[model samples]
Target: MVTVNEAKQLIIANTQLLEKQKCALDEALGRVLAEDVIAPISLPPFRQSSMDGYAIIHTDITQKGTPLTISGESKAGQADLPELKPGSTIRIFTGAPVPVGATAVVMQENTARENGTLTINEYPIPDGKNIRRVGQQIREGAVALGAGSLVSPGAIGFLKGMNMNEVIVHRKPKIGLLVTGDELLKAGDALVPGKIYESNSAMLAAALTNAGASEIEVKYAADDFAATAEALAALIRDNDVVLASGGISVGDYDFVGTALESLGAETIFYKVRQKPGKPLLFGKKDGKLIFALPGNPASSLVCYYEYVLPALRRMTGWSDPFLRALQLPVRYGYSFDGERDEFLKAKIEGSEVVQLDGQESFVIGSFAVADALIYLPVHQNKIEAGELVEVHLLPV
Candidate 1:
């Protein structure tokens, strides 16, 4: 048995980043950049007006209620008609390029119009006011984004603005999932005496997808040695990572761990010092990765977040490796074994993580209402209500 932190370190050290490929901006979402992106042109491209008003020289507005002649009207994307003289102003709309020799803008509400001329109001005019300068947000030829940065909506927009249509990014990894049990049945099947619906497969698949996997293949292996071995072999051959649920504990039907060992896989870790998910197995064979999680629903989710997610991130080439969780104060108190770590299902309420009642390993309803996983470390008996604990936030 090993601790979760030790297992995670081994997994990250073993996995390498996937190959990089040139992809269009639309397909780069959720991908990590493999190359630095430099800005080809300045953002905004030119000095422009920030309001729907008039562009004028600040020196012309020395007296209150002074009137200035209107020279021309300029709207966004329109050509700058002419330069404004000392006593002349140009009618300008929002985002219009500031005309030559103009350094300030006055909103229409602050000025009154009469006889095709505008008069200044009570506000004092300042030079270069309400004008956005070129390259104010991003300068030309500067590194806008560094390598290994995750691409999001803001990143996509920034890349496009910088004329970066294609980018080099790490390829998403492929995953295989296997659910094993003799007493498990798929949905729409008749429930036999000791059978329950198979749910871990679908849940694990969804989680892998959310973690940015390129492809996911799911299968069911009955509680037979040969059948489980066959499924495992196929998965190892087809995917970069394999996630198997159940058949790893010390039971008659627990053949997943034994099968991998028989196949000459170096079992890096067998069990973790954690509750609700002690039967977690991690190993490698032929340069491919595998994870065996307990069949219990809550345990499976906890293991996925703690062990599997970090491995996925490593495979995808994320350089700054760290798990994201909401560190909040506990809302409820409970006691646990002093030698094992525990993850309790909790809901975030008014900045406090309220632990859900009846959080057994098999219960799914509490898992559904849970927004985070509150972790209690080993050697701790109970967490007080106000103690700050690390929380692994879940997708809503």
Candidate 2:
């Protein structure tokens, strides 16, 4: 068995980045940019009015209460703008282009206009007031967003404002999920003695989707050696990454390890020194990655978060793919002396983290309400109340 850090390092060292693809802005949310996006043109494109006011040369407002003739009106989106004659102003609305000779704008609220004449009630209007110069937000040919940046909703709007229809981003991974167990039955099926409803498939699928995976195919296989091998082979052949839930432990019916060996898969690491998911296995065949998780639902989910999720993010060209970590105080005292590191389901209450009940590998009730995982190293046995502990915040 490998240490948790060693396991994580091996997975990352073995993972390779996927190919880049051009993605339309409409469908690029949550994708990592493969290249920097440059602004094609300056934002605003021209000097623009930031308020509904009058555009005039600063010298025209010689003193307080100075009156100037309102030469013409300039509404937003107007292509033809009236020239501002000497000692005169133009009634301009927000986002309208400033006239050629105008150097300042006084908001309408600070001025009074009637009968084609405008008076400034406030004195000494600052030069270039309420005017957004060309390239105020971004200049042409400047980098809008650097590579490795995650495209967010706001980024989409920003890129659209830059007149970009598509962006170059790393392609999402295609995953093949295989669930193995003879005693497992699908939901809504009548369960016989010693049989239970299988839920790991649906649970892991949702988790994968949350991590930005879109192309996922699921398969079921019985515990028999041949059937398991056949199903595993097919999954490896069809997908870039394969995830097998169950049949990796030392039990008599476990066949995932043997199947992988027979198929010439290289075992990068077999197990990790961690609670809830000690039987996790990682390997590679050809250029495809594979992960075999423990049969218990909670163990499988924990392994996915700690190991598989990071690998997927790395493959998609993310620079920082690990879970968000923080040091938080514990709400209550807890004690445990185990041979391996423990990850307990927890929820943050105000400034402290509270460990939830039912943390067994087979129980997932507490995990349902958990928003973080409190990490407990192998050497530590007890935590007093109000003590600091490392916590990893879940993506949700």
Judging by lDDT against the true structure, name the best candidate: 2
**Candidate 1 on 342-381: residue-level lDDT in tens?**
8888888998888898678888789877878887887566
Model 2 sits at a Cα RMSD from the real structure of: 1.3
Residue clash pairs of candidate 2:
none
Q: Which ranges in model 2 have alpha carbons more than 4 Å from their true place?
A: none
Candidate 1 has which clashing residue pairs, if any?
Answer: none
lDDT of each: 0.86, 0.93
Total clashes for model 1: 0
Quick one: best TM-score, which candidate?
2
